[model samples]
Target: MKIRPAVRRRSIRDRRDPLLTALTGLMLLYTLLPLAWLVINASKTQEGLMDSFGLWFAGDFALFENIATTFTYDGGVFTRWLLNTLLYVVLGAGGATLLAALGGYGLAKFDFPGKKAVFAIVIGAVAVPGTALAVPTFLMFSQLGLTNTPLAIIIPSLVSPFGLYLMWTFAADAVPREVLESARVDGAREFQTFFRIALPLLAPGTVTVLLFNVVATWNNYFLPLIMLKDPAWYPLTLGLDAWNKQAGTAGGEAVFHLVITGSLLTIVPLIAAFLLLQRYWQSGLTAGSVKE
Candidate 1:
């Protein structure tokens, strides 16, 4: 009799809650609808885009034509912007992740003076918005003759307060102190112990931070807009915005079709990245749930 009641409760707990399921379905639809619209509209030519329903395909499929034009148009400047974006992602996000990992590991493991002050500063930085710092950064960079150069964007992106805090918290629990003491007793130097032992254990958190920084760097616009004057240096976001604005100019070529097509192209890498790295992200989020 007791077992039957317990089994009934288990089944009840396993059953899906209708309200939660409905909300989840709605959220999924909300997320997918915009992407579907983008894909559908990308297939339309300029004429079709203005005439056809946005949610459905046009009578003529022009996706391939649009893509070819986007690549070959304006001396193939879009390709340059794509390369610039990649450079920012690789150097900026990669540097940020490395620094965050080293700093976070040190903060977690080693005892030092002013550690609490550093923690407070990190927390304060994470609370502050990037936009708030943009103007001051630009002014400082201008005085240093770094403005209108790639360094302006790259240097600022190398510091990620949130990434540092995340790694700090993760390193605190994910790496056990006993393991470090053992490594020390085994004659392992601090750097070797970190590189060989702690690094492998930090994979999930590292990947999570990398993805966050990657997305931020890839989508960055305002910073690049203020930093870069040369069109040759513009990232995809700024370049696309420039193309978008060109459509509104008097006697400018209407490249709205190209703009739409370019937008679709820009998000493909991000989607692929998230899909590829989601396992690590999920694992990172679920860390420290159960006690050993």
Candidate 2:
């Protein structure tokens, strides 16, 4: 028999259109430009910050000095703010992720009355902006005598509609019905089945939701602004804003260099978290994209 003609496989370069590559390059530059500027300016002294261009490093690489001062200045209030931010992230975002996973698994796997109504409510809540509910949340907390407390921030954060929805969608596809049936047949308890089997399978989704909630809680300012009158309870975002405001006031001590460094410091953890968990997030996104 005659050999079949060789199939022409598409090379990587042939598949990548010049227009799409250019557009992607432009998007990458747009996203990274501000971060580059921030990094450059964080290395500058106060005089350099004032005298040199923002996008380039100036006299003296004062990044390390600025960092040390950021931690030690004002009796180490920056350290306190960092700790508060971590506390809020752990309690609020962590709780939200746990709840979302449980609720999402239940919604996906169980048959219950009022389920349709619950779905409708979750979808509606996701569409509602947190800012719109800020006033109402503040009033509710005020009436309960919980204002100016960490609970004020943690409570609202525990109810993440988007995270719940994300987990719900992910769990539906990620966990097969047959696996649950097999686990039940093996006489495994419901909670045991979830904790042992479903939870491991839901890792990617959980990490994704956790990251979203962490970012949201870490950068929270509006809710804290309304709820807390105590500087001791302030998270990094709120504390940083206070510092920036002080710099702007007449006769106020200008620690603009410290502010720049603090801004850079604030994002370092987020960047680390993203870098570490990026694989999980990517897997979650691409899980069902291809047929096995």
Candidate 3:
């Protein structure tokens, strides 16, 4: 059968969506250019870093050696910092995600007096910048003799108002009241209904919240700067900052190289985490797009 001219014209128009294709390409480049540069730079030595092209790999790849030195430098202090970061990210972010999930679920599902006021407070909390709160938190922790402790970092991290808001918004639409009522009708307790039915429904939002908190805590520096003075308790961000400062002094350029390399390494876990959890985000986004 011969194709109609009008149908052929529509096909051409669809293929010629120049604005969309250009925007997509631009966004892809924006996201990927930094990562490409980091990988290329990680392969270079100190001299190669200084003398070579900024966006390309070096002739002599020292990536393996740099990785070794990064881990073993300063009596393996970098490893300690890495472990501390892992602890903070896992405990602080993970705890915060769970709390946010529960809180948001409760706010979205339950009816109570002053619910609006409580939600208003949450929105206000989200608006307040973390940096503005750091000094006051430090003073309070100092009075309690909690300064320079991991708890100082972990405690504040556990209060993610934004995560709570996100989950609350997501749960309001994602979870059906009929399902909860059905679960209750089937003899399921409230807690069991939440855990078995609601939580599973909230998986995508939960993963998104977890990833945000994890990245935020992992990269956090200002709060730690105010709360912590001991090097032993320093997370990767603070530890890298210290290394960068030392690198500025005489005979410390080697430490500078290590710091850059360490920064690159620090991001690997974040990338891995996003790649792993992105499927959940995709599923969550698509879940309500089409209705039965």
Candidate 4:
């Protein structure tokens, strides 16, 4: 009798959620529609792009040609931009993640002097928009002669207040102090206790921070736009913008197809990264729930 009542209530609740499901479906459609358009049009030649409906494929598949031209154009400058973007992702996001992990762990576990002041400042920094600091950052870097260098971009990308906060909160909840005490009793040093036990427990929070930092660093534009002038230091966002400008010129070759194709190519690696890391991400999100 009790099971029957519970099942009936669940069914009623499910029926009542149709509006929620419909809203979710609508949101998915809205987000995916632009991506679908990009893929469809990327397959078209310049003439095909102009002649055919953007939602459908053109008569000739020009995706390979567009890709070849995108890479080979201007003595293969796009390849240089690709390599530069990868370098930024590696040095920038990687260092940000490492620093956030160490700092978050210490903040969560320790009771050092001035800790409250540090926390307040970090929380306040999170409220200040990065864009608002861009001009000051540029001016500071200019004085130091770091402008137009990889260090200009990589240095600023290392700071992620939100990432640090997320990890701190996660460490507080996910890692118990009793475990640290036990490790100490077993004669393990503080760093060993952290590396062997706490770091594993903090995996999910770390991945969450890492993914956000990676995406932020990958898509960053305004800072780099102000900081860098040399084409050799250009990341993909600025490089694509330059290509876009050329496409819009009155007397230049309309490489609109290349722009669209390059845009499509740019997102592929990010999607792949998300898919690759999703398993770890999911496991991390569920880490403390089982209480094992």
**Model 4 TM-score, 2 decimals:** 0.91
What lDDT does candidate 3 reach at residue 18?
90
Cα displacement (angstroms), candidate 4, residue 254, comes to: 2.5
- Candidate 3 per-residue lDDT over residues 76-107, each given as its tens digit: 99999999999998899999999999999999
Worst 10 residues of 2 by lDDT: 1-10
- Which residue runs does candidate 2 get wrong by more than 4 Å? 1-16, 289-292
Looking at model 1, which ten-residue stretch has the lowest summed lDDT? 247-256
Candidate 4 segments exceeding 4 Å error: 1-15, 283-292
lDDT of 4 by residue, 168-274 (tens): 87787788999998999999998898889998988878887788888998898998899999987898999999988988898544678888999999999989888
TM-score of each: 0.93, 0.92, 0.89, 0.91
lDDT score, candidate 2, position 213? 96
Q: Looking at model 1, how many pairs of residues clash? A: 0
What tens-digit string does per-residue lDDT give for candidate 1 at 262-286? 9999999999999999999999878
How would you encode candidate 2's per-residue C-alpha lDDT over 1-292 as one tens digit per residue? 2333222334544666786889999999999998999899999888888889999989799999899999999999999999999999999999999999999999999989999999999999999999999999999999999999999999999999999999998998899999999999999999999999999999999999999999999999999999999999999999999999988888554587788899999999999999999999888777666667
Best by TM-score: 1
Inter-residue clash pairs, candidate 4 = 204-284
Best by lDDT: 1
Error of 4 at 170 (Å): 0.5
